[model samples]
Target: MSVLIETTAGNITLDLFVESQPLPCFNFLKLCKLNYYFFTPFHTIDKDFSVHCGNPNYPNPPNIISSSIIEDTQFQDQSLSPYLLAPKSTIKPTLGTFSFVKSIHENQQVFDSRFIITLSDSFDDSLENQVIPFGQIIEGFTVLETINNTPIESIELKRPLRDIRITYIHILHDPFPDPNNFHPYPLEPSEFQLSTMRFPELSKTTKDINSDNNNEYNALTLELVGDLPHYSIKPSPETLFVAKLNPITTSESLEIVFGRFGNVKNVNIILEPKTKKSLCYGFVEYNEQHEAESAYRKLSKGCVIDGRKLHIDFSQSVR
Candidate 1:
């Protein structure tokens, strides 16, 4: 099957093997459809190497599509004819990518949220038919390699240049490739380019004071406290911008506040059971983070929202 691997930089086509990794394929596909992949950057990219992504505590619950490991006629047929297959190495080099990661258990599969790409060009005979080869990147190897090689730290591995990120991810189709193995089209940009028309300008005095006051708009501290993995890019609608709100606020209030900042595509306010009150913290989705951050700030600090003073912050609102 075909899907797109999106990062903050750009998008690349990933030709996945639904026939082989049925569950992982489905999960990846579902996540893509939910536009979950568009903004999430592979926090750990090993240049011309492997690209690993998916951190559940991401913008959202992380649209992870899972299934039981079952073999059907589709995936049962396996052949080693494919030129690009995951090869085993003393250490799997970040090349000729695979949708997996180094986990705690030998056979444990917590990596359903994490996938890797290979960088090695030649496949060693030792790796022949040993590991599952799901797919290869159809395009943007340079961009992918750049991400892998970038100097950063991995939230999971806690290593630099390990955790790369994309605002979000999406999958598009070209319908011109072979059905058995399609080299899918690259997913298009979800971020909208605002047209610059005759923009409004004010006096320098006003501008300077407003700029200073804008900073005074009140800042919320998000020290990346949670153990949840951080993305190369923050969450947004088009990106991985997950909205957080207080318990007392209703969905309508969220939409009103967030929708006003930008075009809010979806807003979901999670609530606690039994009492059925707002969880005080839920996800708000915007087409971009600029909009989400704007909303978060506007609605924070007694902004006269929902007939009450709202306490908004990035640290999970952990009330």
Candidate 2:
């Protein structure tokens, strides 16, 4: 069985292990069918670990009458196999492995509404019995990367400052039939439950480029993605690739020059390692998209920095 989760960032498709792990897989699929995951925020995002989420709408499982639901006879007494709970010792989950958040309710193991997606290559040994692996993200990994790189409020909370929610869950294939009383929402929820719809941008009327807090947010995002310390392929709308810089031009000078357009997050001037001299081309990342667009338009028109007329374009590679 497979399901497509459409989120604010993008779409993600998961291929579930329905045959081996039917109960939890059935629970997840049933939730999707009933639109129970609608507008559920990705409440926790541990950059080096995983992103967690579930039905924030309810604290406990819904009070459904036993007679209203149908049960698969084969899976009624079937418990999750030992292998599902205990992953291979040598094999660590490497990005996009989906699992249930195991918890103890009334002294029994329960896989409730919550789930988590692996974000890194290394797995912590302590979480071996804490989560049950039942599926893997089969598509939209770029979307997963986008969610993984999202900046949180702080190291302690791990909640995204802005909401990254599941807008819709589109179930592609399911072998089990729905219960008789199962009735799902006909349309997507209209209520917007986010603190902020999006990060603040450089507005058209704002005279001060540094007035907003976009720079801080951008900095946090860059730090989470390892862009500040090391170079990573993060080709985005706000990044610009500049070429033909004067050998004398420094990253600091580039920042000062570009700070006129908007909030300059970072300026990376590529250099020869042996000599530590400028290669005469680098990248300048802005805090917002329009700022980059403005910079691209104004600077692309024969702008000079240090003695060279800089050639500017949107960066396609990592610094």
**Best candidate (score: TM-score):** 2
**Could you give me the TM-score of model 2 versus the true structure?**
0.52
Clashes found in each candidate (C-alpha, N, C closer than 3 A): 51, 1
Query: Each candidate's TM vs. the true structure?
Result: 0.39, 0.52
- Model 2, residue 233: what's the lDDT? 33
lDDT, candidate 2, 6-80, per-residue tens: 676655768887767766677778778777677676767888788887744422343232211113332344333
Q: For model 1, state the Cα shift of residue 40 in Å.
A: 2.3
The Cα local distance difference test for each model comes to 0.43, 0.65
- Error (Å) of candidate 2 at residue 85 is 14
Put down candidate 1 lDDT per residue, 174-218, tens digits, no spaces: 222122322323332222211110112222333454444532221
Candidate 2 global lDDT: 0.65
